[model samples]
Target: MKYRFALNNDIPNLVRLINNAYRNNIDKSWTNETQYVSGSRITQDQLFEELNKPGFLLMVIEGPDTRSKQLIACIGITFYETYAEIGTFCIDPSFQQAGIGKTLLGRAEQFLQIYNSNIKAINMYVLNVREELIQYYERRGYKKTGLIEDYPLDANLGMPLLDLNLIEMQKTLI
Candidate 1:
C-alpha cells in the first residue's frame, strides 16, 4: 500500500468512499438518519477547499496494482496548534477490518507530530450510539473521554442518523 496527499482529482473517489462508509447507517441499523433520508453527501468542492486549508492533511492510500493510485482508503485531519482532529476516516468496505485503517491513523498522527511537539493527542468524535465502531477504535488505542458532543445536522431535513451525538475519543501519541 502507498500513501500520499490527496489532489483535486481524487475528490470523487474520496466522496464515494465517505458515502459508502456512512450509507448503510440508514434506519436499518441506527446510524446517521438526517443524511440518509436525504441525498446528503460531501461534495467535491468541500473536499477541495478542505485540502487547501493550512492545517488540513488528507491522505489517500493507493493500491499498488493501479498506476493511477486509486484512493482505496483515506484519513482526513485538521491540526490546531497543540492538537489535531480526525475529521473523516474511511476505508473502502473491501479494506475494512484490515490494518489499513490503523496504518492511516498512524500516518495522520505522524503528520501531527511535525506541527507541534506538544501534539499530545489526536481527537475524534465517534457515533455515541455506534457501539461496534466505537469499540473498533477503542481496540486500536482510542479511549472515551466521557464527554458527549452534539453531532451536527441540517435542521431542515429528517433522515436516518446514528452518530448524531459524538463521543470524544483521544489517543496520546507524543
Candidate 2:
C-alpha cells in the first residue's frame, strides 16, 4: 500500500472506510463500535472542513489494485505549538491486524517530527470502554494521563449505546 495526504476527492471514500471500520452495519473487519455506539463516525462535510484547517492533515493508505486505487486506511493529525493530537484514526477492517495501522501510526509520528522540530509529544483520546484499544495504544508507548472526558452528546459523532467516557493517552516523542 502507498501512503499520502488525503485529497479533496478522497473525502467520500475516507468517510465510508471510517464508518465501516467503526460501525456495525457495514463490513466491520475489526475495531467495531456497534455494540456501544450507533451512527457514522464522521460526515464528508466535517472531513472537508477538517482538511481545510491549518496544521491539520488527513493521511490515507492507498491500495495497490491497478483498476481501483482505493483508500484502505486513514488517520488525522492536528499540530499544536508543543504537541500534536492524533484522532480520527481507522483502518478498513480488511486491513486490520496486519500491522498496517501500526506502520501508519509510526509514519505519522515521523511526519510530525519532521513538521515540528520542537514537538514534544503526541496525544490521543480513546473510548474508555474499549479496553482492547487502550491496550493497543499502551503497547505503542502511550501512557494514560489520568484524565477522562465525557463522550459528547453530538449525534453526528455517533450516539453511545451506553454511558461512555474518553480516556486520554499520550506518547512523548521528544
For this target, which candidate reaches the highest lDDT against the unseen true structure?
Answer: 2
Per-candidate TM-scores read 0.81, 0.94
Model 1 TM: 0.81
lDDT of 1 by residue, 1-174 (tens): 888888887888887776665564444322333442455447677777888899888888887677866677888888876678886687776666667877888777777787679778888987666787789789888899899966556632234444367789988884
Clashing pairs in 1: 31-161, 31-162, 32-160, 32-161, 32-162, 33-159, 33-160, 33-161, 34-159
Across 114-173, the per-residue lDDT of candidate 2 in tens digits comes to: 888878999999998899899999999999999999997664788999999999999999
Give the distance in Å from residue 163's predicted Cα in candidate 2 to where it truly belongs.
0.7
Clashes of 2: 0
Mark the regions of model 1 whose C-alpha exceeds 4 Å error after superposition: 24-38, 154-163
